[model samples]
Target: MSDAILSPDQTARALPYSALAQEIATLLQDPTVAVPPRIVQALQGGGSLFVMPAADAQVAITKLISFIPGNAERGLPTIQGDIVVFDVQTGQRVALLDGPTVTARRTAAVSLLAAQQLAPRRDGPMLIVGAGVQGRSHLEAFHQGLGVQEVWVASRSRASADALVAHAHSMGLQARRVDEPNAALADCPLVVSTTPAQQVVLTARPRSDAFVAAVGAFTPRMVEWSAEVCQHLARTGTLVVDTRDADHEAGDLLQAGLDVSTLPSLADVVGQTVAWQNAHRPADGPVFFKSCGWGGWDLAAARCLERTRAQQG
Candidate 1:
């Protein structure tokens, strides 16, 4: 038995960010479901190929994303790909989602979900590092999910940062560009790093009651946050990750000399562990949400979109 197939255009018409966020939240609460695992292929030119397959209680989805670092020089997208959804019971093809847009939205939504579960309050300024697609997506997600009051956008390229701020302002957001990385970190209670830099970009440490979401640098060799940030997180006891697997990909933690076994997983937090509950507050020094990009999340988003589209018909 096979399922129906949906093209990227169909997914766009079906699944939007608002609905996707809600569905992701619902799926996180239920632990009985199994999300498909991801297979990564590393290339010689600092690029990676990722294949993620996931099945919900009813349907299944797979997303294939390729990140080629060199694409930026060519004025092309670094991350490009597509997603395929299927019916689990029938083994039928269901839909195809726009990989770039879906990836950007789903990744940010997942981070926002973590913040909702782990962060203390929603009304505050957010600092976003990196001015790429993920950075823009994070801004939109935080605005929609958290109803943030103010947002600070920063990147190594001043022009890129300025452009991001302009885009945010056009969207009716209170946004500003900052040349100083630490200044941006200091201004916001929540900080999201979306850059693909090889080293840590944030210079200053976060406040005790701050939340940090590091969504960049999926490869073991790449790093966005610093060792000091990880060390500070350890000292403050406010570090949380989307998955244990992320630590293996995050250079900051691996280079920080901290035991990977000590990091808490997002699943444990969603499952309501005592350690997570006790230490997962904004009052803590800095709560770090590190994401390695999960395919299950993409499937969840795709499934929600599919249901909505079906209902409309």
Candidate 2:
């Protein structure tokens, strides 16, 4: 029999941001789960394909996705593919999920998880950069996970920025379009940078309480923050990464010449209680959360899907 397939909407409905972030938090502490390095192949014209696989005792999953930065210009989804989930013991295919949706949601959930533990203050306006799929996902994740009430949208395309702003307003939050994202950094305590990393979009130094999550540039060649901005954060604030893989893949940190090996990762913080996290923060500077792609995060999505399926049945 063919494996079941879930459309993007169905898959999204299965993995709510709060639940997804909680799942990721759980997996971070589960040493039994195994996540090997993903294989990335370069495609022509600057695009790339990713093959990621992860497994626990009960379920296994492999995701095949391609990212083409030029798709935005052509009015196409930049990310495309599917994730195949399987039963570990039976070796039978369980289901397939829309890869782009999973990627966007899980990546944002990782940022949400970061914000929950790292943000000095939670209730405030948020700033979103890169008005694309990631931008939309981050907006929803923050709204759902952080109770954000207001937002600022910044992007290279005015139309795209305006559309995201409208979407935010539809969600009943105060929203605006900012041509320069850095200018609004002082007031927005939370910021998510989702640009394609072709160039630096945020240059100005953020306020002391800012919690900035930069998920745009996974490869070393791509970058969204200027060197000075990264250095300032590294010197004065706590620098955390989603995973240790960021030691090599985080363009902003690597380009800024910070030692990724010494940085604290999300896993490091996930083990602590929420109150402990809030109380133990550095309290000196902004918190910079660098997220490079990781297969373990995909595993968390699969686990959530499996749980959702079990609950429905």
Candidate 3:
């Protein structure tokens, strides 16, 4: 039987981010999962459409998301789409899932998972760059996953940033808006960048022992971390990627001219912890996880949401 279309609200309510994060970590370690590079089409006026697919022995999923930079001005989200899932054994359609919600929650949880592995501990204010959907979702993720006591929202738009802070306060978290991201970075032990800026937005060097997750600027044309920041990561920190294909999709890595082949994957960390650690760590520096996102995560999250909804009934 086909499931009803799941709205963003419903999806959010059903998503168990912490548990899902563990599942994602397990999936990452699983050699059987296959997630190819997303097929992107250049739309007119600098817009783009992405078709991402993932599958395994039990299930298959494909998500179609569109990016329209001007949507924010019109009071709309830039990332919008849906994920379609099918049963691998029967080849039957099973569900239609809210794409942005799934993408936002899973992306944040994945980042948090990586942070848990690398970060010494979560005990300070988190600096969230870009107060958009990803930013808000990540705030929730860090709050729930790490018990983050304080959060600082930094955005290009003062209004958006302030609004995010207000939302955080409503959730009983200590939150505020900061116009200067670099200054905010100085004090925060955990930092997440979720903007889609074409130019490097974060120029400040993070703390020596900080944990930074850069989740925006997926395309090679866009960048969140400055060249110097990337250089510092390459030199003094362990640079972890969601996938080695990030060598191609991650703008920060590509722009920095770093050798992706040499970078360690999250899978490596999951499977070979000691070796990965020995190879990637600098004597002293911030650990960085650059995620371009992948379809495998989409499929894993979809399964969890679908199961939760089924049990609810």
Cα RMSD for candidates in order? 2.5, 2.4, 1.6
lDDT (Cα, tens digit) per residue for candidate 1, span 233-312: 77775677676667576666777777665667777777787656665344445677778777767877866776686787
Q: What's the residue-level lDDT of 117 in candidate 1?
A: 77
C-alpha positional error of residue 226 in candidate 3 after TM-score superposition, expressed in Å: 0.9
What is the per-residue lDDT of model 3 for residues 253-282, given as tens digits with 9 covering 90 to 100? 888888876788887887886648567577
**Candidate number with the higher TM-score (1 or 2):** 2
Q: After superposing candidate 1, which stretches have Cα over 4 Å from the reference? A: 1-13, 274-283
- Give the winner by TM-score: 2
Report clash pairs, candidate 3: none
Candidate 2 off by > 4 Å:
273-281
TM-scores, one per candidate: 0.90, 0.96, 0.95
Worst 10 residues of 3 by lDDT: 273-282
The local distance difference test score of model 1 is 0.76
Clash counts for all predictions: 12, 0, 0
